[model samples]
Target: MKASHFLFFILLLCICIPASAQEAKMKKIFNGKNLKGWVEPANKACWTVSDGVLLVKNEPAKKGAILWTEKSYQNFIFQADFMMGDGTVDSGIFLRSENDQIQIGISGSLKRDLTGSPYIPKLRYPVEATGVKDLLKPKDWNTLKIKVIGNTYTAYLNGQEVMTYSSADMPPSGPLGIQLHPGNEMSISYRKIMAVAL
Candidate 1:
């Protein structure tokens, strides 16, 4: 009805544009309600979710890895907050497929002397760890951020630079998986998993 009021309304609409645009650009891979389009390792009792958090109950002496998302991503930044327990736990965030590709995982504090097989990144990182979690408290939450671009990856744990390296050339596309290694009495929790495309 008034010019100044109209101008103020237009300004308000413009101010909200970028905020909504940013939200729209981000893709939430996990629904946080339940597992959908995701896969769990056969006979795995280690993975669960509560209070918007995915919980992996510690199981010992047998690998109980789980892969959460069915869809794959390339050139993205993945961020997750984790809380893990004792008894030397080792887990990883896998990129591209259940049967192929690289993984970013924990070493030391967890005392995981991981030996890789004929896996993709394993060929390049045989027995080498990309991340270490000594700074993470046994009973507290830790933040993790990983950047993946064309087989090159960098990971940060608890705001510390834990790893940075590049693997062999991959397919340039595929899904993502979350893995919980066996041989530890560790309860692992993950939430606020956010990813952005590059």
Candidate 2:
């Protein structure tokens, strides 16, 4: 082959290699067909997949059940689309087990909407998000992005930066969970759950 052609080939390979590696690094936690990678909770009837979306009917008897990821992660980016129906929808995305969770819908008390809020479940204190009221769509799908690096977490709602906070109490690694907070009969759905480790 010509020297110029060989040099161009090398340059092309340099650009293609990183792109392929980056694509391989990202993993889809949800299959959209079934809960294959999720550890099904005791109240299995509450969770189901329909038309490639995970939904919780929120039965009163089966509240507060979390659909947990079988695998755990640390220092990663998680992206998903979620929607909640009318009435009080109290749901959250649990990071690092049951402690650190990004609140998605409303709290039962009706005091805090908590969309895009970074909170510690045990502490009951949330690093509240700003400019989120107008961003969140009621009874409609909203995109949520969360990046956790070490003890620091940054979250966004519908492509808008919401909040960033650091916590020393969170574990280095733990399973990600979707919570159906107890005592509410509100429907919630999640889809396109994708994650990439940093």
Candidate 3:
């Protein structure tokens, strides 16, 4: 063809290549059928899979549990859709380690919905998430997206940028975890759990 057309074609290919490569990096961490990649807890009855959604509830004794991934991740983008269930729904997504977590439902200590906020051990909530009051849907499904790079954590709720925090004490690498806060007698459902390494 013409020289100008050939040059334009090459430029388009360069731009499209990176976009396609990035999409391929994303993988489904949860198979939606079973807990194959996660480290199963002793109380299997507390966690269940139904209709491709992973449901978590407190055991009969009210003891909480954490469903953690077997593999540890460094810097990545994690996304999941969660629906708040019955009772005092206090749950979170633990990043890197249990020390740094993103609150999903009510805060046990604060006794209020702290959804989309970062909960750090010892330091508690260093900063509250903005627009969480309006962004969170009480009984419906909400999307949570977390981007982790080094010590900084950025959170998006329902596709809106909600909060960002930097932790000096965050572990460099650790497995991700979903928490069913102990003694809450709460329940939550999670689906479309995915992550992309950066």
Candidate 4:
């Protein structure tokens, strides 16, 4: 083979190798068929899967539900598509268990749309995300991506960087969870859930 062709081949190989490896590192935590790798802290009836979407519905008869991952992660990137059914739906994506969470919908009483905000429940207040109000789709699906590295947390909404925060009290490792706030009658759906551990 020609020297120029050989050099070009080597360059392509180098670029493709890492991209392939990075893709391989990602693991799909949710299977569309069932709740195989998740735990419902409250009850099974609160959570359900249908037609490739994971639905968390508020149950008036039961307490608030949190669906947690079976496996824990230290540093990882989470990707998912979420949408609210209707009205004011309160929900969030819990990081490293229930201590830390990223707000996905509105909060009750406060009536604030804090999507993309990184907050510590029952502890510190939420750090509001910028450019989130314009990006959020109330009646449509929105893409969310979160990257947690050590104490740093970064969030992206609809392919745009929404916010980044650092916390000293962040846990070293834990499972991720999706919350279904009780009391109010609301429903939230999630699909294409995946994670890549770093």
Candidate 3 regions with alpha-carbon error over 4 angstroms: 1-24
Best by TM-score: 3
Per-model C-alpha lDDT, please?
0.62, 0.84, 0.92, 0.85
Candidate 1 TM-score over all chains jointly: 0.67
State how far residue 111 of model 2 sits from its true place (Å). 2.3
Best by lDDT: 3
* TM-score-sorted candidate list, best first: 3, 4, 2, 1
| TM-score: the better of candidates 1 and 3 | 3
Model 2 / residue 11 / CA error / Å: 18
TM-score, each model?
0.67, 0.85, 0.89, 0.86
Candidate order, lDDT descending: 3, 4, 2, 1
Local accuracy of candidate 2 as per-residue lDDT tens digits, 1-198: 999999999999999997577556777899899999999998888899988899876776745689998888888888899998755788888888777888887765545698888767566655689999899988788999898999899998998999998887889999899988787777888988888877
Per-residue lDDT tens digits for candidate 4, residues 32-113, read 8899988656478878899999988877673678888999999889989998885468888898877788888886646788
Residues 1-198, candidate 3: write the lDDT tens digits.
999999999999999998578657778999999999999988889999988899999987988889999989999889999999999999999998989999998888999989999999899999999999988898899999998999999999999999999998999999999998888788999999998888
The per-residue C-alpha lDDT of model 1 at residue 65 equals 65
**C-alpha lDDT of candidate 1 relative to the true structure:** 0.62
For model 1 the local lDDT of residue 80 reads: 80
Please give the clash total of every predicted structure, in order: 3, 0, 0, 0
Q: What tens digits encode model 1's per-residue C-alpha lDDT throughout 1-198?
A: 899999999999999986566546666666687776676666456767667888876655556666667666888777788776555556667766544433333453334433111135345343343334355455777777776778777667777765666666555777677777555566667888777777
